[model samples]
Target: MIQPLDSVIVHTLTRVITPVIQLFALYVLIHGHDSPGGGFQAGTLFAASVILPIIAFGIQGSLSVLERRAIILGGIGILLFAGIGLLPLILGGEFLNYGKLPIPGMEASARRHWGILGIEIGVTITVAATAVSIYYSLRERGEGEEK
Candidate 1:
């Protein structure tokens, strides 16, 4: 596990800011279709929030929370995206044809909008989970210790 930093201020700030970063990430994800930020950017932000704590407090704490669930989260993301895409096909439309997403009572354009939002959500989850998983895999096994 990586060693925690000794600076109390950094640790304290990390604790305070992580949630804010995560909330911003969600905002970015939600507004992506209408603006510049989207799933990848938001996902990076989310991952950075988790990574900040790891950098400040070490992998020990983050690992306990992320270790087993990261892959599951990734899978959930994939399934959500694929399910939404395939659903259009099952409803007699082309793959990823968001207008056919079968969300009853919505007009085609609204269905399309909601479908795209769901896709963005899936992408956000997948990218964030993948980033954290990669960070864990690439982190130093142990720091400042004899082999």
Candidate 2:
């Protein structure tokens, strides 16, 4: 059995810091287009936020938060990315040609902006799910061997 920490300071600090980490991850995700960060970086940070509970509480606790939905999340991401690409084709343009998107109120550049944002959201989901899946797989393997 995995032993949790007994220190009050450790528990308290973890509780306080985890939300801040998650909020910062959101900030990174939102501001990525205008700044140095992007989907990959934000996803990693988001995964790190998920990981903090694992470190503090254990895999079972973290699994409650993550569930078994990692693969589903990845699939959704793939669909989002591919669907956006295919949309342009269906609208009589080349793949991922954001200019061909038919939003009535938006110019071509605005359409492109929304398209990029959609792509980034897809990438973020894929990366975060992949990272969490890997972490859970490794932890499960390690636990299995200890028995």
Q: Report lDDT (CA) for all predictions.
A: 0.86, 0.81
TM-score of decoy 2: 0.91
Tens-digit lDDT track of model 2 for 33-124: 79888788888887888877777777755765464568679889889989988899999999999888777898999999988888888888
The true-structure Cα RMSD of candidate 2 reads 1.7
Return the clash pairs for model 2, or none: none
Query: Could you report the Cα RMSD, in angstroms, for every candidate shown?
Result: 2.0, 1.7
Error of 1 at 80 (Å): 0.9
Query: Candidate 1's residue-wise lDDT over 65-114, tens digit each?
Result: 67546878988999999999999999899999999998899999999999
Residue 131 in candidate 2, Cα distance off native in Å: 0.2
